[model samples]
Target chain A: MNRMSSENNLDKPKEDEIVRIDFAFRKELAEKVEGNLASFCYQCGACVGDCPATFYSDDFNPREIMLKVLYGLEKELIGEDSVLWLCTNCYNCTERCPQDVKPVEVIISLKNMLADRGIVPKTVSRIIDTFEKTGRTVQLSSAVTKERAKLGLKPLEEIPMDEIHKLLAPAEEDSGK
Target chain B: MNKFAFFPGCMIPARYPHMEYAIRKTLPNLGIELEDLPEASCCPDPIYFKSKDKLSWLSIAARNLCLAEDKGLDIVTNCSGCTATLSEARHLLEDEELRTKVNKRLARIDREYKGEVRVRHIVTVVRDVAGYEAVKESVKCKLEGLKVAIHYGCHLLKPSKIMNVDDPNDPKVMEALITALGATPVRHRNWFLCCGKACQDEDIPANMMRDILSTVRDVEADILCLICPTCFSQFDHGQVRVGKRFGEDFNTPPVYYFQLLALAQGIQYENLGFNRQRIKPKILDKIETTLSHA
Candidate 1:
């Protein structure tokens, strides 16, 4: 059986197809994720079997993401319209990966990289802004308070925004202070 | 009675306060005392917040932990997202370097992650700490003959090294809890499938939820019982949307495990806010009828 002649021979690249490894991007991801778990993935499709996103979407696959990570394909993963957000962060991939790749963490690091570049989705940005402002993602409206009171639950306490603001300060601001 | 710092997270308190009401009413009866954690922020949401800034997420989660630590009590979280964030943060901060890094940020708020307390999901607190026997004994109205389909969701039991609540693949915690309430926990197809609430794409979560709902329907379960509020929102409110999208009637009512416990422990059905739910649990009617006949 000549494996290269088979119809499923996409693994065997043509003479013109070349994957450029962006080592710098890989280093950046490594700095974000401790031990660089992405490097451990051996292309086992275990992560895909249980992935809800992969089951529904043609574009999203954790194994493929890991392969791209190995090749240091940062541009493909961290853009505004990247497929990374399709991930539910379920950690099923982390559970099923035989090599302990923790593909979800790798994808999250990629997401963090995308976020660092200010390419956040509007919904996620709203949550971030809300958290920064109120020290909670969902605002406590008067209606919410009324409902709690009806349930005999205690009234909502205000989070210390000043303390949260200090923690949310940018690196430059912290250093400058 | 064991005392815990109750970390309700955002969704339960802000969106599904009834779940909070049920927990407050039930846990005290089951030998667990709830002390509210003052000034605790969002577990900052484990997904989007972490995606934006890992350090800030870790710091915010640690700050929430500090609220419990100051009270010298372990934390019990109702939402799976909060448990995952706090547990994973505790697991990561075990590394001296990361702890120091997080502490550097925490020092800004006059706090530190001394790793003094443990973060536990409310389900684990009910099962492991309070024991299933206590649950059975506390039941004034057993959910007898009710078939419950269990949804463990994702964060409550996954990334085994960190969450460590149960076997992510073959978890029996939720089922055991359900059975203790005098209901039969039906093992439905796609039992291990995530509720897909966290998936951003409409089609992905819709399909994922449709798969789970279809299985729950096949099992003929009276209600889909779950621990996470996010899953509750999906199967209860989101089910209407998913059913409409897929053109199927997924009328399965979703009930939080604590709500079931509150009901079984003799909390009035009306007081628990079932009326506010999108898809009302028909089993509650049956229970009410049975109680009246008795």
Candidate 2:
């Protein structure tokens, strides 16, 4: 449990832990990402035009996320209300971006940054919990197994459940640690 | 002989042993050697990406890569998530500042990567290293007339530049390998669609299953060829639940890309973990029939 406590402490920003915003952080982060030619973006809305997710839902706007990053709106860009989660990571926006701004990569970078800060949504946490419990993220409940048999499908042989439990025992212990 | 540092992500050893059996049996015939990396940890998928801890994720992945580099062989992965994460980390480590930051955190583990090794997905190795002609020559049994729908899972091709094996939208290498196995590659619209595995948490599994079932039905193919373990598990296992949810009978064919290759090489179904799958299509009999006729 000491390790978990330490991890929790590390995630919490101290009074002086604020990263001084400079052009260098943005430049370095941008350079580390692939296919993001942010300098080429001239605010042409070609990316907005091709984003299917954006048109269907205001929750996912690649154009706005890109604009925020380019304008150095670090707080607003990485804020909790940002719609970065809605991205399907489909690369559709990257393909259609006329200026090669690569909103897809930028959004991924933002997500990665947030994850570092330990702000992952509860839904994602459950999945990781299941993955940690069972080696597989998607576990078929017993009812689902019966339904499978009703359809004339064979029941999936459990992969040595006890053995798998042992294999995954370490991850659970480590997570707790 | 091409010797590769093997990275079998968690799923292959525990759930999908068929993929492991196929790779173990086939790679040797192709003159590719897979050296076991025993201490290799979980690719820490779904969590690493969802957690978005760049330092921890990169550091952990770099530790795995550094293990391979220590062996002085190129790192090869059968899992798409492992390939994507490792490749992304490899690219990030190329920057001196990023490497220093990542390595400093990883200093606890006493691991640092010098960016000397290459991370290759099994599909990339088969297409690039083995070549179509070599695959054709190794086929003891050809899968003639077996219709297959190739599903290049999202992680393999997305952020297309890092994994620039082929065009993400119009990938053909998997199809070419299927063709070399003497099978017919079926084209479908949802070929480019995400298995929705990435968003399985957001949507109900039943909804995601329905989406997957609809995609399989739309293709109307005999079997769906998958290059990823996550997609394989989703399509093969998820289809059953999806059918029950929709109150419709949908028995879509699902097989790994290497499983098809192993079958083409005459590996038996039981050994390839076929019996462990939820859905066992009549297509296995068809494959036997086709092989006997040849």
Candidate 3:
């Protein structure tokens, strides 16, 4: 991993060299200082040892992902076409993390970075679009809405598309900064 | 009386109207005034987290906080996700570097977050202002013989420092509230499980249904009391789908904490939106009689 200078400029990396990311961004993003507990992981596989999803699918391994992030292999960490999306953010890893690496938040931060680069998985993109288009994520098939109405509940209101666009306008404008 | 600018989030008004109704009806009796901030949009929870746009997420939440500050009141939210987002954004904005980055973006909308307002979950307000003794006094009925399970949804407890609601591992506020209502709050395994909202990104319906069923079965409680909209939707709607999946009769109980409070307040089940639930008819009947007698 390249050592980043303790400076605020985003253009510190040489043309051919990889950018050395600092813990400040992680602290700013996570709202807590990166304890760098990731450095303490010895690849004992304790985290992956008990992960339920790892047993079912080879694609999901919390320990491997944390090691990649810790090694500053951002390319491999975020570029992989794996089921990192399957992590439920269950915090089982956080609870069981011997080093308190908080792989849960680390994965969340990594996913956030990938998402900003427009590399979100397809299904995840669709959910985001649904939330963007409609204020609510749960799209009750028309039949489900009717069933709810029959049960005396008001049909889920279609959040006015214009209102959603308006709400998003600020965030959209913010990204340029 | 403490005055709070209330951000109901979209769920409380549209789908879970009874939650709004209950809070509106009950808080005044406890001397807390909840004033709604008009034109508040969805907290943009799914998009912000999924997109990993921390600045944008913070800006949106900061915008809401600024709106509340303009009204000269601290913000109180009924949804745990909203509380988490707003509170987290407030903390981020307090940092000079983060504040500059976030506000530069927010400046486009003419909203600047000064971090003057405090964002709190409704449960925190109840525990802080009303106190257990006061809540006990407000209870018109005791929920004796009612076996209740408390679901402290993920956003509320996790990231514990920001929430500060209770000990994340063993939250006693919701349990204390249930116990105050005179119900037996049962401790269950997996009580702290995520409602699988995060996993819903992959398989919209399937994962949600499975997560709800597994957790409900793990807990095996008569009724589940929740503090957030996402959890309520998952358990309420997911129970319906899960019952269809296994063909095995699975009728797990679910209700909002406020609904139980409404019942204790002698409010009618219909008024409390019990009829709006997607649970088995048998469970609804039991809740109806329980509230009616209360």
Candidate 4:
């Protein structure tokens, strides 16, 4: 009985607990956007301390996102329902990270990866479509024109859509994320 | 008067034209001439556009910058989001490779990012270019005894390497600007928390607004003063939404910084569009009456 307590005890690893680092995804993110910034994170969680998203949402954490980036877990980050959309783009993490990791930049780049796959929230997609069509995200309607006139301000000028269209053109035929 | 290519961005000119009115009314008194950058689009939007495609974001921002360079003038933006986008674009384009890539896109429209002109937020223009003393000199009826809680929204001061507008951790520019206007600047407990307007999820922004408004209430400030239109919308219109959800009366009146400046400069209360705001600024009415007698 005593032998089972002392001699039979051994440290063992769980199968599901082990996370494999996806170097290919990590290398892709590094090359496409941030350029080796996520690799510096030591997971001090300084970014998590100031992040409002983390404070409010149970799921959104910049430190965890950075850890996933470090582990190259692309499946968890780039998706339509991924928690990356909750970022708020406040840049608090960019200011607080001791590693100069710029976690917000990495998060944005990940969102870019999602966008590359045409996975975006409806609200974001609508804003992009509006901007693509009229140059401004908020359209200039008769009401806006009337409001400007009421203030004695000049009417809003029309954007040169011809030029804006040229600028909004996609960079290449097959630019992969 | 120093000339600037006034970039109104999307929000102010479209949604809050009165903020634009206050800006136009006050800037001339401080010796700033606003030259409109015609045919300028959105700073394409600081967040979603950039997140979707960084290259497209840089190209659109550079295109706006070119409009200013054409007139041989620097840009002065009223919206913080616009300032961030343009500032980040200017900062990133300094890399020759990135500049060439962005410029390659710009060439399709017959424009180039020469990196000639700089982008300046209106707050910086007021504090640094015009000087705080000049701001004081322009105040005809001082806002004495009026307590203003300043909200320095995220885009104005964060990612310090790109923004460089102020010390992000301990920003004193907004407080100093408030002091120069003869108003008491109340540093509330939650001064650093963002208004959370840009967060996509509805609940997150709702919760963040509750935290912000509660602190402003605790301090008993007469008005919540901020420079960004996006933050102004959150506190003004979004304040109403938060009150209904939280089942509490958070009727803190928010005034855009320039509107407060316009009031102190003796612009008539009736003309400043206070009546249109969601939360009526009853405290401003008291100050307006006092100024009328003074």
Please give, for residues A58-163, the per-residue lDDT of candidate 4 as tens digits.
9999999989998988889987699998988889999988889989888878877888799999988888888888888887778768878977999888889898
lDDT of 2 by residue, A1-177 (tens): 253577556565556755454575466456433424555667777777756456446566777777666665667756565566666555667767766576766776777666546666777767666645554445656655554444343444433234323322223222223
Question: Sorted on TM-score, highest at the top, how do the candidates line up?
Answer: 4, 1, 3, 2
Task: List residue ranges in candidate 4 displaced over 4 A.
Answer: A1-18, A173-177
Question: Runs in model 3 with CA error above 4 Å?
Answer: A1-58, A72-76, A79-81, A91-102, A130-177, B46-52, B200-220, B280-294
Q: Rank the candidates by lDDT, best first.
A: 4, 1, 2, 3
Q: Mind giving the per-residue lDDT tens digits that candidate 2 earns over B173-267?
A: 88898999988898776677666555424344355456556666787788888888888877877777676667887787688888888888887
At residue B209, candidate 4 shows an lDDT of: 90
What lDDT score is found at residue A161 in candidate 4? Answer: 89
Clash-forming residue pairs, model 2:
A4-A177, A115-B51
Pairs in steric clash, model 4: none
Across residues A47-68, which tens digit of lDDT does each residue of candidate 3 receive? 7864545644557788887766
Per-prediction TM-score, please? 0.94, 0.75, 0.77, 0.94
Question: What are the C-alpha RMSDs, in order, of all predicted structures?
Answer: 3.3, 11.3, 8.0, 2.9
**Fnat of all models, as shown:** 0.81, 0.14, 0.24, 0.79
TM-score of 2: 0.75
